[model samples]
Target chain A: MSKHLKHLLTYVVALLLFVFMGYPFLYMISTSFKSLESFFIEPFAILSWPLNFSNYTEVFTMGLGRYFMNSIIISVTAVTLVVLVAALASYPISRLKFKMNRPLFLLFIAGMMLPIHATLIPIFVLTQNLGIYDSLLALLGPYIAFALPISIFILTQFMQEVPKELEEAAMIDGCGHIRIFWNIMVPMTIPAISTIVIYNFIHIWTEFIFALVLISSPGNMTLPLGLQRFYDEFSVNVPALMAALTLASMPILLVYIFAQEKVVKGLAGGAVKG
Target chain B: MQTVSPVKTSKHLEIKKKKKKWKHTFTICMFIAPALFIYGLYVLYPILSTFQLSLSSWDGNPAGPTFIGLDNYIRLLSDPIFFKALRNNILVVLTSVFIQIPLGLILALLLFAPLKGLRVFSTVYFMPFLMSTVAIGLLWIFIFDPINGPLNKFIQTLGMKPVAWLGSPDTAMFSVLLVIVWQFAPFYMILFKAAMVGIPDELYESASIDGATGVKKFIYITLPLLIPTMVTSSILAIVGSLKQFDLFYIMTGGGPSNATELMGTYMYKNAFLSFNMGYASTIAFTMFLIAFIVTVIIQVLEYYRRKKGVFS
Candidate 1:
């Protein structure tokens, strides 16, 4: 009887913790669609309010459109490059019987330990020197670098998993290295690549430090920078802020709704090992 | 008679082998070129320059920078603010391992049970990780706002005085810690739950055969197997806490006399607010140092624990 009671108690605790963990998100959604009068009054009214879409309208009109556009451009461009580079680089490093391969692998892994905070001032100075300090390209350079180690690590592990026998068979058929890589290896790693793209997209989309310090002008602000503007002022309408936040999270949420499985597959393995 | 000709041809084949070595070198270069060129030009070069800047002194203003060797490093060593920042980072590390991770583990264990609607509960728990940290900070700021905030309201409802959460110096660091842990524990919970699922069923089955209690089985079987994963998770938690920027930067801005300042926040304050490029580089190096040290220590600890048969 006590064993059954204990099982019952654990489930109750799980439900309560789930609610506690998710309250802010629920509250944000609630507050975003809420009438101004009902903002503070509807504390935990999970089932009470009708949806209001005005805040989203306010978000698009009030300069967040550009930020949203910029986020897309930066994340897409960066993630694509990170994947392409990681694939090519990781392929040879994992496959080729070269003398310096292990050390080279170690080099990128060590680079993983280098903190973004450490690279901040130097990257800013370098960007400034290159005359692109306030440009989108400047943000991509450091983000790509910072993302390389993990991308390469993940990609290398994935590339190594491809059957050597397939490559051997292709080699015996007079196929060249590039042909085998394109036709045989690339297809197998697509899931890993997709996971990389999604993970890196979310990571780069939300990255604020490089964006904040590197790009000063309003014309170049990313979502984190734009969200920060609301934070700077004394009286940003809480509902409007929530509205903008909800909009900012759309890409991540939409992707997650479909791709949470792949994400768990990707990170759970990497997380356990490293 | 043909044997003589075959031996002569075999000697000539050695020349072909020499040329094949060069061809292999070319193929290797072709494969690695674009990756190296891009990474070298952008990522590798920036890190090198940052390390160089850490050794010099210059404010990052339009006049460019003047070189004063080791001043930033000297200043960092003697600076009270840097020490305070380091202390706060350590607190984040401690709270993660001691409070957050353990709580996450227990929560995950509960959530991993064969209860009804566990899937729905799992999704709900992981919701915070998918949300924006900036939005989270803003929400919590209001939640802990001394006036008309939920925290104070709850206290008032209980017939108690309100505590200044984000306002007071003494409470501020703990307050920030609380907010971060709340936002992040769900993440650890889901990750830990996934790890728990990988533990083999036979371990539990065997333990049950030996008449082991559930708690005893967990301590003996589950925790040992999960140690390596927990270590890696803890490292991520430690580093994430160390490099935490958006939440602390927006919520507190390391104010109330630098009470809530972390390494990442302090680096920003130095680099941007003061335009002290050299000092910021030094602080950045300081972070790199701490991360490197912590990572090394974790590796060593893992080694020793394994050597001592602690996990086995």
Candidate 2:
């Protein structure tokens, strides 16, 4: 094939794959705007013009708004708690000389291999015993715990590479370990911290099994659980369901778009290194 | 008097040093305490307790569990559904390792070439990985919906009968796998692409100069250089496949006579749906053991390969 023809072929192939990959998302967005009649009548059409906005409104009226707020609260709290705890714990393991540092770090690292299902029953029991069952508080502990391994791993690796000279200089000025950690270490590891925040946010936002198992109250249900419930309850309402899915996914999708580079790099870094 | 004073000074200095050491240890503990506490309470405790629970019969109630020794394990070994779930999980692992990774690698290679608008294509391809798996599951569910779904509509247009993609036992597993691949192949693609980008351009240039172009150059240079990444991604894919719960759970609920029941969903059903906590724990423990074993095998293989200087 001629070079130009070959390039055109590549473009054609790329476009085909792009459509194959992206059509679902596009179909979702288009369908959300579509009326039920249009959806049923012309299912494969990319878009039915004269967009119906009622699906978006209907989703809000159908308790999606409550689920959205619940998700935001849980995800934000979990991310904050995980980032703070992981950063604090990672600093000592990464920088200080402690006898149990390696073992402690390994302990957290081993948590990565732990499948959440293995711990589900015990956690469910523990939450009930602790009187946090059927509440949002029940999720916080597990979310932070599950997020620790990767957060600590990434933070510690990043922290270890932080120039020791800065810490030494701080010490020369009579700064204590805590002060140095707060001032020098935290600011320097912002990239890693942001990565942790983004990751934990997305994770806790979408986490379902735990949410489903733990929180039984309809009022306390997170987005995924809420969406699942909505799907079950309104099995036939494709347009409204699509709208809810779109709404549920929008926040994280926006976050990913805004911080695409950091998200990608962070994920890539964590995966490759870990 | 001078000798006595000198001994007193030494004792004073020793006490000060001891206090300083104590202070340092206290600071270290303070830094580590919060994470350790949460991790211990939530992660470590549950893991140990799950093992304990696996050995006993319980209804997930406040009442204590009854010790049943190895009965749960024996039951799991004999259970047909457990075996079915296990089969599904193994199939997922195989498909992920054999299919997803290779497909991802091929896509990565395609994008690695200096194609125009590659960035746009890359972003579009990776968009699915950014969305929640639940959302992806719902999206696929819509796509496979028997009546108004796009897939069936397309089939009808092609002059064929519309299949109930997720409703049939025969096609359910395949449908679930298709969604899995669609959702995750881009992730592996990005990983492989990152690894490929790191390969020195001069290697490709050198190969092309030797009249080895396209397939030959890729086979000799790109493929070999990407092995480390392939190995890592394959391990990731396999482990991920083994533990997959959300997509299948949300999509099929391991349904149509449990044709798509994975180990994760099976354990979940036993614990939550049936309230067979003991049996569920046994399944969970077994899942953990398999994950651990798979990881160890991969690590051992990686070790041998590294020892042989297969990786740079």
Candidate 3:
């Protein structure tokens, strides 16, 4: 009898948690399917028939596509650069026995705690001096630099666990360091590489402060900035704003749905050891 | 196979070895240069520049800055809003450590319960963590809307008056902190879940054989074993709390009379809104110092804890 009571109690708690966490998402998506008049009249409805699609059309027409494209360009470019550069740096730090290896690795790992606000003013000033203050190109430098620490840390940890015999054998066969790095270390660290790619891609995709400070042009605004501006411009249009948010959030949600385990592991990679 | 003289061959081998060492050193430097250059130019240099700017009085003009050594810091000592923001930031740290961490452990435990539809429960629980902070903030604003929001609607159903959750000073900080907890608890859930997975099954089995109940096993086995992860989660919470900006900026902009202002939003207001770059740099530098000091303290405490555990 007590076992049955415990089972019932578990379901009750689970149900309450599910409601707390999931209702807002359900409401947002549901409200996006309602017209303005319907939303005002029946704000608590669960998206019944005669569903409205105009909110999606209206939000898309209002320059959300530009923000999406900008986010894609910046996130992809920055992730690619960070992966390649971090891998090259991690190769020597993890594999070689040079005197500066440990200190260099520590320098990069220490960056994980450095707040971006500390760098914002100087980076803003530097971008202005470089004449790329409002351009999409302005974000690449900070994005790649800030991403290096965690990427290099993850890559080096994974690389240290890689077996050394094959690389030593390759070295004996007169293969150069570049060749061994490309052929051996890069191939071996694919899991860590993927972790960093997913990790950095998500962060850069939603990055706000740097873009908010450096990029002022409407055309160059990333998704987060564009979304905030859109809300400010049309604060009363709740349905349209929900539509915009739903669209803005689709990519990451889809990625999580399809690759749930990978996303979870990638996100927790910073705080937990695999 | 060589017929050459031994002395000449040995001398020739030494020259070759020297050349190889030089090549190796060059390769190492080449591999590290790009990452170092970018990190230095963007992160390291900016930190020093922020410190330098904090010592000056610059309104971000075309003309050079006026160096008023330590004036910004001196003024910051008496700034009321700065202290309020600091107090709010500490509140977030306390909320994250006490509320979010325990709530996360509960949610993670729920996922492990012998119940139905756990997959569905976990998926929804983690949904908030996956969305952008801006999106989450916007969604919650409507949910807290006084006239048309669901929370007020539910209150009306209870025959109570509607409250302006984000508009009033009394509830503004609590409302935003609630949303923050909702958004972040799942993250700690995953962290705890990962750590729980690492606990050996043999321990649980042995506990069961010794006639231990579920609560007893949890207290003796699970809680003590989660100490390291708890420390890590606390550090993440504290550091993350200090750097928080986006959600508060979107939800309240530190408004309703500065009730929700954080150092991040305060710094942004000074730098971008007012162009008080010098003062903003002071706030930013102070943020960096607080985070650095807190991290060092936690690590030292952890080191001693581990040492005591080893001896005992």
Candidate 4:
């Protein structure tokens, strides 16, 4: 084929693939807006009528609002602990060379590689023994552990790139280690910190396995669990389920839209390093 | 100018100053202590305890477990569903590494290409991955509804009849696989795109000048350069797919004959539903071992690959 033909062919194929890639999500958003009577038909009917938001209303009314709240609380806590702890932890590993530094860095990186499926049962049992099995604590603790390695890894990567002269100059002024870290390292890592925060947010937000295994208490369901529960109760209510699904996903969706460039750049390296 | 003290007291102050020279240790310890303690308490200990628990029978309702060496593993080997789950887990991993990578790369390439509207396109393509499993499960359930779903709707558009997808054993595994790929392709795409950015534009420009075309450029340049990342992402994808439970739980519930049950889902049923903590712990160990082995293999392979290459 001619180069023009090849380029055209590639572009055409891409457009088609893009549509196919997005169809289910498009179907989801549309179905989220579809009236119950028109749920299945609207896909073919081409929506000559006005879009409805009653499903959204029903979803909110039907306990998703509470699930939303629970998810926000758990995710916020998990992200907070992950960012704060990883920030503190990455300082020594990144700036201060010590014995077994390389090995210790590898250890945390290995944690990034370790799949938590292996650790699921023990978490469940541990939570039960601690008697907080159904509370947010169960969810909060593991998320911090699971998220630590990556947050630390990324922060260290960013920290290693900062100019050492700044810290050296500070040290010359009689600053203590904590002051140097808090005043210099922390501020210097804001971009990386925000990036880490967003990554942790998305991960904790979408994380399902630990939540699935540990959160047995219906009252403490996260968004993932809440959506699962919504599905169980409203399996046939396609519009409402679609609405709940859309709502469950929209926060991160918008977050991705606004921060996508930063997200993509940060993730490209971070993800494959896993 | 300092406070007047005896020579012996001055020596003690000097010792404290020497100790303070290792101050990074304090910051390091303080930084790592909180995360390490929590992780060690919650994550690391449980892994060892689960292994210990697997060696014995206990409903976990009691204060202690009865030691029964290797009995749970023996029983697990004898069970057919155990075999089924193992096969299914392997199938999920294999399909994900072999099929999903290529698919995700294709999508990533499209997003990277001069294709119009790249931003909107990539974002939409990445949406399913962003969607919670709960929502994706429900969406696929509709697609697999056998009557009113888009999968069926499009099938009939081609003048073919819609068949029950999730309703049959043979089709059920593939059904879940479709959802798996849909949900995770963006992860690889995002990773590959990052790698693509690192590639010097001149290499592609040089290739084009040599009369190299699209696929040729991708093959000679993109593929070779991305091998490390590809390998890394594949390891992640394989490990992740091995333990997938949310979709398996919400969609088929490991059903139509338990055909779609991965080890993670099976462990949940055993440990939580049936309260067979011992057998469940056994299953958990097997998964841990598999994940550990696979991860180590990737790291070693990457290590060797790095050694042979000039790059780190």
**DockQ, all candidates in order:** 0.60, 0.74, 0.81, 0.62
Question: How high is each candidate's TM-score?
Answer: 0.93, 0.96, 0.97, 0.93
- Answer with 1 or 2, whichever has the higher lDDT: 2
lDDT of 3 by residue, B1-312 (tens): 476698899888999999988888899999999999999999999999999999888899989578999999999999999999999999999999999999999999998898777788889999899889989999999999999899899889999999999999999999999999999999999999998998999999999999998989999999988888888899999989989999999999998899999999999999999999999999999999998898899879879988888322
> Which CAPRI category fits model 2?
medium
Q: What is the C-alpha lDDT profile of model 3 across A33-116, one tens digit per residue? A: 999999999999887569999999999889999999999999999999999999999999999878999999998988888888
- For candidate 4, the per-residue lDDT at A272 reads 40
Which residue runs of candidate 2 sit more than 4 Å off their true CA positions? A1-5, B1-13
Rank by lDDT, highest first: 3, 2, 4, 1
Chain A TM-score of candidate 3 vs. true chain A = 0.98
lDDT of 4: 0.81
Error of 3 at B182 (Å): 0.9
Interface RMSD of each: 2.1, 1.3, 0.8, 2.0
Error of 3 at A102 (Å): 1.5
Candidate 1 segments whose C-alpha is farther than 4 A from its true place: A40-51, B1-15, B303-312
Query: Which lDDT tens digits does candidate 4 get at residues A115-215?
Result: 57667778887788898888878888899988888888888888898799999999999987789988999899888888778778887888887887778
lDDT per residue as tens, model 1, B1-312:
667888678767877887887787788888778777766766677667767887776776576666788887889999999999999988988998888888788778877687888777777776666666776788788678786466687788899999888888999999888878887786677678777888889989989999999789988988887887687778878877777778888789997789999888998988888877788888888888788897788779878988998754
Error of 4 at B83 (Å): 2.4
Instruction: Return the TM-score for chain B, candidate 4.
Output: 0.89
Over 4 Å off, model 3: B1-15, B310-312
* RMSD to native, candidate 2: 2.0
By summed lDDT, the worst window of 10 consecutive residues in model 1 chain B runs over B57-66
Candidate 4 residue-wise lDDT, B48-105, digit = tens: 8889888989887767788899999899889899889989988988888988888888
